[model samples]
Target: MHGIEIAVSTVIFALRDDPRNDCTALGMPLVRRVRQPYEGSWALPGGPVRPDEDLTDTARRTLVETTALSPTYLEQLYTFGHVDRASKPVPGPRVISVVYWALVRPEEAERGIEDDNVAWHAADHPPELAFDHATIVDYALWRLRTKMEYSRIAQAFLGETFTLAQLRQVYEVVLQRTLDPANFRRQVESSGGVEPTGEYLVGGRHRPPKLYRHRAASDLADNGPLTRL
Candidate 1:
């Protein structure tokens, strides 16, 4: 079944909601397909895998070709193989698609949107997608929300030196809920994913919020399971 195979793709995100503190909401680069099947329709930036390429490399290449973005944090999200994942009237397989999710800094990703039709949409909301992408998007969003609750994912979506208020916004956008400032700050401190850099923001109107940075990947426990629910 080598000829009848599928490939992996990613839904990469970067936070861009920081005008107040120079932060920005989370954004994902989307492409308007130029070829057939779903031509002119919007889709996640990705493509088929070459015979010799590894899946992750394929995902990365597709990201470059479609969106010009580099993924700072990439991981396999899930496999989607519904019977009609594709809409080809011709010949195509069952169209099994391995989905991945990635995160990058917003400033770095802004340069990735090349096409006039290609645009950065909020990671929380997007236009009507092609094929079974809607379902894939739902699954990816669920994974992101659940994983952020128990994993060190907040850093992947934020800058190294971020204020507590900025970090809270990441949770708010992804979880689609407002978090109490006191509770969120306490929880982040207790989780140990971030540590203060002995700096305070001075420009904001209210009390200066402390600045913190994300922990390096090596700091987290990597021996066994990586879930926290």
Candidate 2:
């Protein structure tokens, strides 16, 4: 029996606040492969796991090396080990990918564009990706959308202190719909996921909205069984 080759991949998402577009949209960086199997194809940033490093560490390292991004939120997404997942036909061993999803600020995502091989693409409508990366990104987006309903994961996309409008924009972008500002504010306040920072965003055309920050982790809803991991 052949041993399975383990690898790590990360789907790093950022909310691009485009002035022309009313709502922000999710974007992620994809790297163009320079080697065989899927040479010149766009794919998630990843690498084979080292024998000594833990899976999460490998995920972080691969992300940094490929995109130079250190996301504020990183979590194990899912594992894919399908027999035909690899683009190349290898006779030795099947490959298994431990995928992770990360959330970084828009500025960080923009900085990553310095790499010619790495470019940000819309998460909802990415071009054809190598291997099973397209499917992996879709699943990761689904996870993010679902988690936004309960967990305070949306805060990860924002800075330390942000206006309610900015916070709501994160939700609108990820959820792919406009939320009723009044109702959305009520729901979030009732959930106790955020608290006012006694600050305000000034100098905007509109009235200054109060700045808020996510509450302590314990105050947020538990992400079911996965939270422990």
Candidate 3:
């Protein structure tokens, strides 16, 4: 047995053009490890937690250092620390990772650095990953889809103003299902999570669609009681 080491990793989700589907799909960035235990394998962006640095700040820093992305919506997801989690013959102290998940707007996501070492992959069908990152990504996807059912978190993927159709598309792409346009519109309007911007989208051939934005006073999503602390 050896001393425990704390680390921070982030799963950043974004909507990107899925050439396979010719539409927007959920994607995430992975950085190729330059050193073993799994050198050359892609893994979530992260690093050893520096002394005196907060967990959230460390999570943000890892994203910037690896991917150059700074998403606005970030939340602590869960901690992963199993004695056998990395049972492979690795020469290092046991690592316990505090994981976070984030959502980024399309424009912001496009700015992420994508070189040979860092690249975006389709979240649902990601390639081989190092350690237990595959499991971590599954958990993050579950949490995101669960929250989308009852929260305005979907707005995190859109611009400040969007049409109802645009908002619904986000849910559909993430949830992997189709939502009734009428029902979705009615629910969103009644949910008090968004407000009309009093402006309509231009450049469309059909009648302009009224633009809406998340209510300024509302949090993207209800984070439970811990948010109050």
Q: Which candidate number maximizes TM-score?
A: 3
- TM-score of each candidate structure, all chains considered together: 0.84, 0.90, 0.93
With candidate 3 superimposed using the best TM-score fit, by how many Å does residue 55's alpha carbon deviate from the native? 0.2
Candidate 3 residue 73 Cα shift, in angstroms, is 0.4
- Per-residue accuracy of model 3 over 147-192 as CA lDDT, tens digit each: 8887779999999999999999999999999999999999999899
For residues 1-229, write the lDDT of model 2, one tens digit per residue.
Answer: 4777899999999997555766467988899988767778899999999989999999999988888899889888899999878845433457899998899977786564678898888899998888889899989999999988767888888888888788888998888888999998898889887899998887865768888988766323244786676
The Cα error of candidate 2 at residue 85, in Å, is 0.9
Clashing pairs in 2: none
Which scores higher on lDDT, 2 or 3?
3
The residue-by-residue lDDT of candidate 1 on 167-196, one tens digit each, is 888788777788999998899899877888
Clashing pairs in 1: 16-24, 16-25, 17-23, 17-24, 17-25, 18-22, 18-23, 18-24
Model number with the top lDDT: 3
Q: Alpha carbon lDDT of residue 129, candidate 2?
A: 89
Off by over 4 Å in 1: 1-3, 18-25, 87-91, 202-207, 217-229
- Per-model C-alpha lDDT, please? 0.76, 0.84, 0.89
Candidates, ranked, TM-score: 3, 2, 1
Give me the displacement of residue 141 in model 3, in angstroms: 0.5
Order the numbered candidates by lDDT, best leading: 3, 2, 1
